[model samples]
Structure formats: structure tokens, C-alpha cells
Target: MSKRRQPSPSHPTTHHGDPERSFEPYKKAVILGLRWSNDDLDLVKPQAALLETFRIQCGFETASLVIPSTSSEEALNAISQTILELRQKYDMDRECTCHMATLFVIHYIGHGVSETEWEFDICGTRRPDAVRIPWSSIYIGMKSDVLILIDTSYSGNFLQPCHSLQRILQNNDHHAEYLFSTGNEISDQNGPTYDKNNNFTTRLTDLLYSVSPTPVTVAQLHEALCTQANDPSTKLRYTPQYMDCYKPSIIIQHVEKNDYIWKIENTTRKAQIPTGRALISVCILGNTVHGQVKEWQASLSTMDSDVTIEGVFNLQGYSLCLLSMPISLWNSFLHPGYNS
Candidate 1:
């Protein structure tokens, strides 16, 4: 007779190779500041100042500042040149080696009519009504991991086309890219105010500074700002909104062991005794009648030996054994429930 072989281990295993860690060299950050309204230069001034401070604090290997025409025709030409330079440097052309480490920080501090149109002063004249910052334009020559900050009316509407937090989490690319907005619906007609004590940009700047030691997720930042804004007396309300609309059907390329585990949990069911039992019985059902017959006979094998045959047969109906496999084999069996 042939000897039986023990089954191999069923659990998935992972091997971590030799650890080779290296720090990423300092990257460049391009700051695009668009402050169109002359109504509150004070409110706008700090935004630009905060950007400069953020750049200095980041200590990047390289940085560029682009301020479009907030005042004159000359400003328009400057803005166009700056935009062109940025496009050439970071756009998909791959012309500049610096492009790989570049992070475009487009800051729009003006007024947005809706998701599509932003009214900003290209020149001091304010003759040109509203310019559209197409989603294509925003992501032009950059990686998908860009960080965008817009402080304007209807800024929240911009996220109307991006993916939501729930989708992002489920899809496993929660950190692919992020968008941060200062208000919801639309900027209040009451021009942005700077409460000498605290302002939106300043508070955010402080938060970023504090976040150096602890990396903050986009969701965490949103929650923190919301909590502060809810308070009644907080000098400057920081209303941050995450763009949850644009569901680009791109399959996230990067995959980690954790990502697979997360996907399995979202897509599969937890192991249960009844489920396991059902699966085992189903698999063995067709193999032999002997086990089924024995199970039936055992059900009739009651404690009371004195019980009559009729009584034993009656008890047999209630004595059926629900077979179950070991917990390790749960994944190997067929799924018990409905399919997606």
C-alpha cells in the first residue's frame, strides 16, 4: 500500500529581501499664485507670504515662483511666459531632467464661478472675465501625486469631478494625489478677512510646519481643519475640502502586500463555522455514499440503547452532523455566498 503524504502549508508567505534604504534627494516645488481681487490685498498678501515661508521651510533643492498678472498688460505677458516655462519644465514632454522631482503647487486665491471658470486678474484691468483651469492644464507636466491648494469661491466645486475618499480607500491608491480647498460651495461674498491673530493661510502653514515629524494624510488634514472651523471663536476658519469627484478609471500601478490584503478583505467574506461546514460537506457529498450513510446511521445511534427502532429512526432526522473543514482550508473551498 502507498503511504499518505502530509499536505503542504496553505497560508500565503512573504519573504523580505536584504534591506537597502536610501533617501530621496530634495525635490523642486513650483508655486503658482493667482490673487485677482484688489478688494482685500491684506487677505491675499499673507497667502503669498505663507507660500514663500512654506518653500523656505521645505528646503527643496530647487523652487520657482509664478505670479500672474494681478495688475497690468505687462503682468499678462509675464504670466504667459511663466506658464509657458512651467509647461516646458514639467509637462509630459520630459524635456527637463528637473521634471522628475518637480511638484507644482498651483495656488489660486481669487474667485471661482463654478468648477470650470475662475475669475482672476490676468492684468490689473480685470477685463478678461473668467479663465478656465482645465483639469488637463492642472496636471499638465506632472506626476499624478501632485498637491493642489486653491483658496477661492466655488473652489470645492473643482473636486466635483475627482474621486472620493471612500473610492480612494477601496481602490488602494489613497495617496496617489490630493486636492485641498479653502471653502465649500462658494467663497462668501464678504471678502476674506485676516484676524491679525489667525488667518486661513497662516493656520494651514502652522499645521504643515507641525506636521514635519508626523506625516499627515489628506483625510487627517481635512478633519483637523473642519474641527477648528466648527469652533465659534476661531479667528480664521480653515474650511478644507477634498476633491471627491473625478474618478479617473486608471488602475493604480503600485501594489504592496498590504494592498492585496486590503483588497481581499473588501472582496471576500470572513470565515465562519457554518460556512466551512457547508463547503466541506458539499465537496465530499459526491465522493462517496458511505460517509453519508454512516452519518445517517450515527444520527440514529442514540444514547438510550433501549429506544425502539421507530424512535431511533425519528431521532435520526434530528441527528445529522454538519461537516466542517479546518480553518486553513477555507480559502481553498468554493465561496458560499453571492458573487459580485
Candidate 2:
């Protein structure tokens, strides 16, 4: 939630606070590796293994799916099914008190051809002969955090343009982060030696492994990758690009250690009013709470004397409340219960 600046050379990656303190890891991690041809399995297998190992080491149950040499239709079907399965898994995990946040990582390495729409060359045939699939064909319904890494040529085209306002406010529940190998340019998938060993995948996995013990968030990884790409000594050919909305930028942990940590932090640290105002969105079902606006305002005002509800308006199911506050009371609202 800090203001953006140029990527810091010194702060390539961030560290986890209090190593002695144990915290809940991601509820589950599902990795999807897709390749247009079987030949690309050489890169996919090891990349998937690295991701699985990294997630597992961070105290998460990991599942990996690597699909090779399939038709675009079949690939889309498989991806859809995987996402459906994840949605089901999340629903089941919700029954348990401990498990809440879910994370999915998708890595695609293959031929990319752009025309009317950005397409993946599933069969690796050039142009008209290619069995192409549009990047946005599959539906991603899960509200959990998604990290997608695309290593094909023109991979940056895979990311849908997001509004700057939405990127800053981050009001949406669904969160997705992206890391693309190239920005509208051809990615060096096969590398100069044609080994696929010295490209984005290798560099990414190396960063992940190196920033261990301390968890590395998507933003941190992106920053480090950008730094590496900009460094002339690294001799990187393609520039990697990442996009993320800056709400609560996801840490590796799905849940904090305990309620006591929040209590201690709140009591000890003085909340700085970063913006002096906050807009809170709450969803209420069945219009039951529509009549309780004043009561709600009264209840919130008790938390801090300077805290006052400026306005409350209902848009569809969401109630948007504008609050004038002297300090950052937003963190106080984000407890374990908010995850549900």
C-alpha cells in the first residue's frame, strides 16, 4: 500500500518478519504448465518441479499439471477443468477454519502468434495452419489469488489492460498477478544455445529459490526480475513485465499467526493516516441492513473519535461507505474473518 517509485536496486526482494514466529502458509497451490509441443516439456517439467518445490517448502500443499502437445480446444478444456477443480477444492477448504486463501500459478511456454486476437499456437503450425487458442477463452471464476507467468513470444499481450483507478483502489475481491517474458516482442524461449536453460523460467526459479526463508511476494519477484533485466551485466535479451493491483499485495502466507499479533500491533503502532480518508465496501445480502445506516455509523464512530461516516450508498449488493478518519483504520478491518 505504499506509493510507487522506481524499482529499488537495494530492495530486490523482501524478507519475512520474525523467523522464529510460525505463520499459516498458503491454503493450497496449484501449478499449471502448458506447452504447445512435447519438445517444450524439457523446460516445463523442471519449471513445474521448481515451483512445486518452492511452494511445498513454504508450507503449502502443491499440485502441478503439465500438459503437452494438445489441441487448442483440448487445452482450453483441460485448463477449464483445472480451474473448476480448484474452485471446488476452495469451497471444501472453506469448511475448515484454518484454510482460507488459495493461490494458483500458471506458466505457459510455447509459440505465440498475434492477429485479430492474441493466440497460442497449440500445434506449433505457422499462421493459418496453427491450431490457435485465444488467451481469454477460458473462464477464471475463482476469487483466489492467481499468478500467471507467460514465457512465449508476445506474452505481454496475454494480460488484459486494467484501469488505473481499479489498479490503485483494488476494490475487487479477485486478485491476479502476471509476469510476462517479453513486452510486445519475441521472447527467447529456446535461448541462443537452444537449451531453454538460460531464459525467463530459469531466472524466475533462481530468484524464487534465492529469496527463501523470507517469503517473496509477486511484486518483489517482479521488481527483482526488472532489476535483473535492466542490469547490463546480466545480458538479458528480453524485458520481463509484471502487472499487479496494489491493494494488500499478497504475501506467501494465507493467514496471520494469530489474533494476538493484530492486537499487539494495533496497540503498539500509531496508525498514520496515509490518505486521511477511506472508502469501505461491504456486501449485504437480502437488503436486511439497508435501514441500519445511522446505527452502523454510530458503531464505527466509537472506534476512533475522529472517525466519522461521511456517506453511505448501496450499489447493487455492495454498500460503499466514505469515512473521514485521522489514522489508518483499514488494517483494523482486515482480520481473519474478512478472508471469508
Question: Each candidate: RMSD to true structure?
Answer: 18.1, 13.6
Give TM per candidate: 0.43, 0.54
Report lDDT (Cα) of residue 112, candidate 1. Answer: 40
lDDT for model 1: 0.36
Model 1 TM-score, all chains together: 0.43
Off by over 4 Å in 1: 1-26, 37-40, 61-80, 87-101, 115-139, 153-178, 182-199, 235-238, 244-340
lDDT per residue as tens, model 1, 181-206: 43332235754442423545555666
Which segments of candidate 2 are over 4 A away from where they belong? 1-24, 37-42, 66-70, 90-99, 117-128, 155-175, 183-195, 253-340
